[model samples]
Target: MTSPHVAALRSVALNVPDPDLAAEFYTEVWNLAVADRQDGAVYLRGTGPAHHLLALHPGEQTEIRNVTFRARSADALPVLAERTVGAGGRVLRPVAPVTEPGGGVALIIADQDGRIFRFVHGDAEHDVDTAAVPDRPVRLAHVVLNSHDVSRSQAFFERALGFTLSDRTRMMAFLRCGSDHHCVAFGDSDRDSLNHIAFLMPDLESVMRGGGRMKDAGYPVGWGPGRHGPGNNAFNYFVGPFGVVIEYTAEVLQVDDSYPTGGPEDWTWPPGRIDQWGIGQPPTPAIKEAQQAIRFMPAAAF
Candidate 1:
């Protein structure tokens, strides 16, 4: 069977201890606006056209609900459901109308490792918010997932979701559904968890300015103000409240099928450097621990 075509990474849903408090930090400090609220959940939107970039729900602790993606067409949903099952993944929910904020037909599935994913088609979108806000995020850049077996996770994305390998670093395998290098990546790890979520800043200046804003808000940069070797993106990472890791990034390299996929050897930096630029400090213990703390909510939670 052919893999379904995924258009782009859309949004992410999380169950946090305090939805109200999380909403406040995301809107006031992280620059996302409140899009809508329903069923005691607050939906947050970036400046770009996707309906909502994040959905914060009340829970006992912070855990990822699912990573969402927009399918290239509505027909891809059923195909994805079928391919997911064939690829050793389980279909938690068949294609059906989404009653949530976005209002689209969605398919929910879990990989063999139990990481949940949702694919939506014909979702609602907002008019571009072009208010000239300097440090506001335009949209989601990517989501990095930790995998005990990176190759197995990568195969699921390729055989089930039609994502292409953009590049492979020693610690991560970057995969893409569209042109922005990688919409989803898998980090080599001993557990299945969320590594981080990246928000697309308007420019390099915006990324730096965002790092300063986070520091002013009492959340210091956990890693980087540097360019990455794989995506060629400028990033500033922070460990947010409740140990949720997030990043402000810009200038992701665009590519097509013709682009060469580099291996780990091609992405190496100098001894003290973790990214393309050698200026930033290595990832902190806080961020490293936070990366492996947020795991996917159980499938029964759906």
Candidate 2:
């Protein structure tokens, strides 16, 4: 009966100052091809099969130190690491499997904002010939965070990553881990690192052909071809390549368990609820004038 959320996001490690220009801007805006590189780390994957989803290294300073996921085997990862230390969350770091020709069983974890999530168990023998680049990349749905206390980081990923809550406001919150409405999301306003990382496109012309290939690779589009209102998906936000805050969503909003949970959609702030999925479009006034020329120095102001 081992199953306390079997990990599911295998790789997302970035420390890039310039790991080959963040692997050539994630292989020219999300084609994600390179799957290996040594010591100075660089491994990306997405054309299919998942041996990696993105990892680059070249740190000097610049945060978002970690975020990984994947847990469907190895006997349910120590019962999901004892439900992430019984929900108070603290497993700092651990490592073991390094095997490669497939068969999966990798691990890495950290939460409560040291933020890193990696876990693999099986499947990823390597694929994606793409016939000649017809198009591929169908999973790894969402990963967003910018929490000082977005309701205790959305109640710690809905209590250690089973993640089911679907909508909210007071800054923002939209969670879902296994069914594709959203894999992760959190925003308590006051920003910094880890704010975007989503992938799930099959419609809206593949989110306007991946936002017109990240606007013809000039790269700079933080926030939406627009449509939100909580996981109604159809979103877009960019400024990736090492610092990451990228997304390219599609139709989101799915629920079960009768669809209700928590009060005020669970924390007030619901107005038109960020457009409630009517192709809202907002956020790119040059991404709010580059987040109003950043000055938010909190975390005890360093």
Candidate 3:
């Protein structure tokens, strides 16, 4: 039987020490607009149709609240919930109406390692901005999570979330639920943390322009401006405020069920090269530290 799946990665919620400051950086420097403000939280949107690509909430420390995805259909929710439990994950909240910025029926689940994921169906969408904006991101491309056990995490995503493995590199495993090469990826790490969040720029020009803009804003590119082998995407990464690693990427590979899944052997780079195009510098010490610093908030705390 074909497993139920999510249609796309919708948004990510983050707990930041100062939501307003984070909101300012995202709006002024990153090009995302404020979509909504509720209590002390802020919802930000990209040029895409998704209601909001990011939500920032006030917290004592910065941490990932949850990564959200859009379910293919309402029927998929209960089935996914069942599969989640079967895969050793817990249903943090049963399928119910979401009261947050994007109103939808959501099923919140926590993987065995305590990483939270929310699957929503019937969420509101904004009118898509079709005009080409040079440095603006259209939507979330993918989220990379650090996993202590790559195999176990991969199994849960496959069995419970119906995500297919797109590729497995030496340090990471990319998984997809839809056409985009990967909606989520797992970076092998000693602890479970958020590796980074990637935003989809309109094109290669936008990726470079955005990187320049970030540099102008005093945030240097921590790594990239290079094409990745597995996804074939051009990227520029930065360590944003509160040690949150963010990326601007474009030209992500799109694939169907017929696409072949490659192993680590297929993704090796030459000596002194980190990506397909070796023009970019390696990730800085700060970037490396930040990538593993933002842990997910305990499921019970949210």
lDDT of 2 by residue, 99-144 (tens): 4433356555555655556566664546644553533445567776
Expressed as tens digits, the lDDT of each residue in 80-178 for candidate 1 is: 999999999999999999999889899999999888999999899999987859899999999999999999999999999988898998889999988
Candidate 1, position 90, lDDT: 99
The C-alpha TM-scores of every prediction are 0.98, 0.31, 0.98
* lDDT at residue 24 of model 2 (Cα atoms): 83
Rank order by TM-score, top first?
A: 3, 1, 2
Q: What are the per-residue Cα lDDT tens digits for candidate 3 across 70-93?
A: 999999999999999999999999
Off by over 4 Å in 2: 1-46, 51-83, 86-102, 106-118, 121-125, 132-136, 143-168, 174-183, 186-199, 202-204, 208-226, 229-273, 276-302
Report residue 291 deviation for candidate 1 (angstroms).
0.9
Highest lDDT: give the candidate number.
Answer: 3
The model with the greater TM-score, 2 or 3, is 3
Pairs of residues clashing in candidate 1: none
Residue-pair clashes per prediction, in order, are: 0, 20, 0
Off by over 4 Å in 1: 1-4
